[model samples]
Target: MNVRREGTAAKAAAPTKTSGPPASLREAGAALAGLSAVFLFEMLDNSILNVALPTIGRELSASATVLQWVTGVYAVVFGGLMLALGALADRVGRRKVMLVGLVLLGAASLATAFVTTAEQLIAVRAAMGVAAAMTTPGSLALAFRLFDEDGLRVRATTLISTVGLAGLAIGPTAGGLVLAFAPWQVLLLVNVPVAALAFIGIRRGIPADQASGPHRAPTDRAGALLGTAAIVLALLAPTLFVDAGAASPLPWLAAATAVVAAVLFVARERTARHPLLDLALLARPLVSSGLAFKAAASLATAGLGYLVTLQLQLDWGWTPAHAALGMLPQVVVLIAGGALIGPLITRVGLDGAARLGAAAVVCGLAVYGLLGRFGYGWVALALALVAAGMRVVGVVAGTNVMRGLPADRTTVGAALVDTVGEVTTGIGIAVSGTVLAKLLTGDIATATWSTQQTARFHEAVTRAGLTLTVLAAALVGWGISRARRPGAARTASSPGH
Candidate 1:
């Protein structure tokens, strides 16, 4: 197997000024709009559907387990297929793969109108997950390829992420409002129009792929199978923990399966001639460190969000609507913070910006762990700080990952960044939920809790928050060490580094 160092391959892949005008947000407005829509679907679909689950249950006469699968299956399939499909995109054509995925997304979403059973909806959601796997990595990869300048790449990424973040933040509320007037099916059917818009924009704005010859290496089928099995099992373990509790052997078994698959997958990649993901590329300081930073940010964000939502609704006696409103601080900061990323990256280099953002997330988690029980003010402050941190780290870390890879590998690199975030987010939520289940005696979803139960709930929150804080801090420290290694100074800023 021939493996090129990240620095050498990056230098070879760097685009010159004469390559043509750099694809700025203004110049690539249509493509960016389309890509933003793709991300919006991914972020919005689950959040919005979650709000309508009760309604779906009533409509379909579904049990709780079926309802869980309705959402769980989508995440499992989406996370599992991302890396393999990303490699496929790199080999075949990013634009071609993305367009086909949009078509599938549209068709699957349209099928929502005809679905009558919970099983059918699960099937449709799984199909949508497949579509997401195909399109999401391409969105980032295509956007990175569009821009020749690192600064433009940062700004473009920030813009796309902002749109998706907005969708995530508002999805629940939007779904509730829509359900008030329309059927639950409308929530998913909305994707048809979104897919259509993305399809048109991508077809017109993005250029066609330049084909690689037939002599290109074939994809490593064994690596793809092992990689997908590992991720699917890893993602499944958390949901199993939440549903089956810690004492149940099912979650533990799933966790063991995940670990074994991951080990075997690594061994496969190391030996494969045309590996789905070249493990050596991850040795690059920027690539690995950037992924570490993203994982840290995602872990903190998801855990905090899950814990705080429960705190407000179950423990504090806030209504669902009120709890949603309470989360406004995070949404506000995430949306408004995009303007700050460029200035921050300009002041601090990308690596510095990533470290700063990661530190803020740790601090935010600490605040919640220590002081959140005192008042809503502390909780709000924690939310804003974490949101701000995530905003910065999300853009800079992803850009750094893209910058570290050669042109042909950007899709898979983007997949790696996303896969890290997905897995860590699942772990974070699982850890928090499992801790709460172990500590609290009664049903957590009950409207009224005894003083003892409430106290236990608060303790659970503190323990979970602090645990996540320590883990995130460790990840950030590791990332900082990696970023400071020799040759790490050759960042995207130089363009010709």
Candidate 2:
């Protein structure tokens, strides 16, 4: 196989203005509408499933272990394939790839909704993971191409993040509403119409964005396979430990395989002419630091959201609809925080914004841990604080990550952020769920509990909150150092301080 030189390929793929009228509200409106739909679908798919897990388990007679796989498998496959698929989007046209993904996602959702068995549902969900990998990076890459100016790009990113986070924030409420009238399958079916509109938007609204010139390298098959396998094994191993006994050999085997695959991936990427991920890109301080903060945010929030749902619906004996309503405050705060991102960044600079968000998270989680046992009302307030902080940090971190990346590598940048999110989200769930399971002496679906078990469960929640607080504090410390470094204040245009 012939390999294109890196410099020549980079020059060929360099940024060029799209073939359309200059960036205007009309164009941005169309692009945002499409991108939001795609992002919303992906987020809703993940969050809605969390609310439906118990219902699905009851219907399918799924064991605790099988149920874990049902949820965890999607993240494993989606995150694992993201980098490779993102690179693929750059090589092909971002819009073209995204349109295809939208179609496939719709088809997969239809199939998943109709599945009769737990095993079949998991398999179809895995297919949806593949579809998400194809779309996630492409959506962000297209947004970059759609808006050439830095200000416009930042604004577009802010809106995109807002839409995606809203989906996550509202999914339980939406799912609960659907389940009130329909079966658990409606959660899976809901993606179809949204995906259909997204397909039309990508096809008609978003302009084409593909690398030009003759020096592009062929797809990196070896690196893609190795990277995908490494992530899947690594993420899957933790879920096993969460559901299966720690004494089980399967988790150990999976971990070892993951390590081996990861080592081989590093070796292959260093030598491969067209690596799936540009290893050098990962070394940049902006990229690395942004990823660290992003992962930390996801790790803390994803697990907390899952636990909150369980606590409300199971421990507190609230109905699903009521539990969903309980989440509204966080969603409202997130939207407000999203709108304030640009102003906040301008006021405090990028690093300062991240530090502030981190500080808020730490303070909120600490207070929640101390008082969460009092009532669900207090827990809602804590979640609102966490959600606001997460939105502020998330928007800034994304802007920083994308701003640091070369125009030629938008898809790679997008994929890196997403992969970090998916892995850490899985880790958060595994750690929190495993602790709860251990304390309760039952599965996650336990319908009844003894007073002693309930007390232990509260202890687990408090421990999880404390752990997240410590992590948030550490992130703020790192951000402060990054801000204080010499020459860190170079560019007003750069998102990072």
Candidate 3:
């Protein structure tokens, strides 16, 4: 890849002339604070509704499957759109696109608060997904762009990622507090002021950067459609067959369409003047493996979060705050893993890091799965294990991708990182949600379950758990074992390689 500067760090520091003199550290701090607020909102919003799932259902009389739409819809749409929007940021100014995203996000949150019916709520969540899709990619891309020093960029990235888990760390507690005094509607409404504050801050504090060249790159319209089609199909396939009473042929047809679209997407990326995404990057083992590891990491973490929240509320009758707060240990270890031990592990190479870390995730999953089969008492201890495992996975996987890419591609790469993460997370939520839904509908309740229904619940949960665990293990091995290729053949500066 041809970079304007080959060094690991950006050469020029922030100019005091363009944006007033707040001092470098002060400026970086403000930028970080801005991102912290915005990033947490983006991250926590994913599962804040999840903690309230059971309570919302009881209040609104939502069906088992419909309740999950609150979380599932947001994930699928947000993840799918990010890939397109990432490219958009590269082509346009990240700041302008960011402000637009913030406005939409704030408005959507307000709209979510007013939603009354299950369908309205689902639609609002999907709208929020779109807002997030636009806002999040630009923000992350800009974080990498704005921070000139590698040390600062790395620290900023760790901070951005850490706060997301921190949001999850407190989401249940916050949701509970909100539900205690106010309707669940207040939960979403809170996002508006936070987003508005962020919007105002970003407009005033952040300076404009150089724009993409005058020659408009062709929008990867077809590729965008294809990518969206694949995710929609993957998420809807099981749900359509199980929930909608759709014909068997319809689900398979959807899957077939996705396969065809993917083929077209790759072909288009290779030939297009301005491709939506560079699919050729997948030829690099580290990049491809990074994507796969990202997917695998989400599956493990999402599954753990999903089951823990459900078990606490549905089985043991814990409060939402209790359920949410109960996950604190997992959060702590995850943060430590990313910030502290990750760099040391990567110093040894990606394979060693992935091997140790991926195995840690499997061991954690197996332990938690076993504990889940019994009762709630074993949770806190088991979660410690889960945290350590997930932390390793996140740290190693992130290092694999971030360190391997060129400095200039940081914007697109960060967005791509988010895209892979969200898509995998969306898939995990959908798959696990499907399993939980089936169990809930059948007879998995602690008090009100028939023998046959109980059997069905176990069967479904077992299937989901086993499938995720197996895939996590296999992908971890595959990702770590593969030979990594050099960074991209085509960099931003190298117009003619």
Candidate 4:
């Protein structure tokens, strides 16, 4: 098997300087808008849809399990196919693949209006998942390619994420409001216009694949299959655990299958010529550490959001509307935190920003575990801290990962970052849910709990929250150690290589 030489790898990773003036976000213009829309759709789709699930169930006469699949299928498909599609984009054309995805998104979303059955809706959602797989990774890769300077990359990423985070923060409330007057189908129909805007902006703003000199490596079909299977099973295992409980053997079987498949995929990649993902590239300090930070942030964010939602509604007896409002501290921090990115980077550098942000996430989780049961103020504080930390690490760590990879591999690298986040988010929620199921003797869905049941619920929340805190802290600690290594700091600071 051939390995990329150290010098060759460095040369490939270095930014190619042009004779013209340096690139800026201003020059990106419509391309940034297009990328932002792509992210917005990814973040908003499920959050908004979750609000309409009960309505969807009632209208379609769907069962509880089927309603869960309406959302679960999208996540499973999207997470599973991202790496394969990202590799395809690198070999083919990122812009071309992205445009095709936009068309599919619009078409599938339009199909919602005609769907009367749960099965049909599920199929439509699965198609949208495919579209998401094709586009989400490229959004970051293309943004990185748009600017030669690391600062510009960070700024561009910050801007794009702000839009996406805004969508995530507003989706539930917006969907609730829209449902008061409009049909649930209208929630999906909104994607049609979003897709159109993205298509127009990308077509006008980005150049064709041939213009930038696309990669010509042969596609690795075996690696793609194995990798897809591994990811799909890994993602599926969490849902099974949440729904099936620990007593069931199905989730364990899925998990073991995922591990075996992942091992096979690694063996294949190590030996295959023109592998879908070059394993050696991932060994680089920046790449691995950046992914760790991203995983930590995602784990904490998803776990905290899930636990807190349950706490407010199920444990504390708050209404859904009130709980949504209760979450404003997090929503506000995530949206308003964009302004802090540039200044934070300016003061601490990317490595510093990531470490600080990661540390803050650990601290926030600890606070929630220790003091969240005391009062709402504690919960709000915990939420704001985690959101602020995630807001920074989400942008900086991703930029660092892109910087560590070769020009041709940026899309795959982005996929890896996203894949880590997706997998860890699932694990985080699984851990929280599994613990609650094991500890709370009463049904969580009951309208009211007995006094003893309530005490057990509080104990479950504390134990689960602390468990997640320890896990997140371990990941952040590993990330910090990786960043502090001899040459990692230099590599992170100097983007030109």
**Backbone atom clashes (below 3 Å) for every candidate:** 0, 0, 0, 0
For 1-497, candidate 1 gives per-residue lDDT tens digits of 23568777888889755646455678888888899999999889999999999999999999999999999899999999999999999888899999999999999999999999999999999999999999999999998888788889899899999899889988988999999999999999999999998998888778888775111469989999999999999999998998899999999999999999999999999988888899987987888899999999999999999999999988788988899889999999999999999999999878889999999999999999999989999999999999999999999999988888777888988888889999999999999999999999987877788999999998999999999999999999999898888856664433532
CA lDDT of each candidate? 0.91, 0.77, 0.66, 0.91
Error of 3 at 467 (Å): 3.4
> What are the per-residue Cα lDDT tens digits for candidate 2 across 1-497?
12558777877899976666446646667667888888888878878888888899999999877887787778888888898888887677677778888888889889965788999999988989888999988787677667656557667777887788778877877887888889998888888998987887777777565347111678889998998898888788777777575668987799899999999999999999888778886655566667767777777677778778888887788897788788787778887777787787778877777777766666777777778778877887888878877887777776667766666667778888888888777777777776676666655467788887788878988887677667766766675565455534343245422
Question: Over the stretch 270-373, how does candidate 3's per-residue lDDT look in tens digits?
Answer: 88877776766555666667667776777777776777766677655677558756777677787666666437454754446555666666666666665565
Candidate 3 ranges with C-alpha deviation above 4 Å: 1-27, 51-68, 112-123, 212-216, 238-253, 307-328, 335-355, 368-382, 392-396, 399-409, 429-442, 446-466, 483-497
Preferred candidate (TM-score higher): 2 or 4: 4
- On a 0 to 100 scale, what is the lDDT of residue 135 in model 2? 91
Query: How accurate locally is residue 63 in candidate 2, as Cα lDDT from 0 to 100?
Result: 88
Worst 10 residues of 1 by lDDT: 488-497
Of the candidates numbered 3 and 4, which has the greater TM-score value? 4
The regions of model 4 sitting more than 4 angstroms off are 1-22, 489-497
The residue-level lDDT of candidate 2 at 397 comes to 70
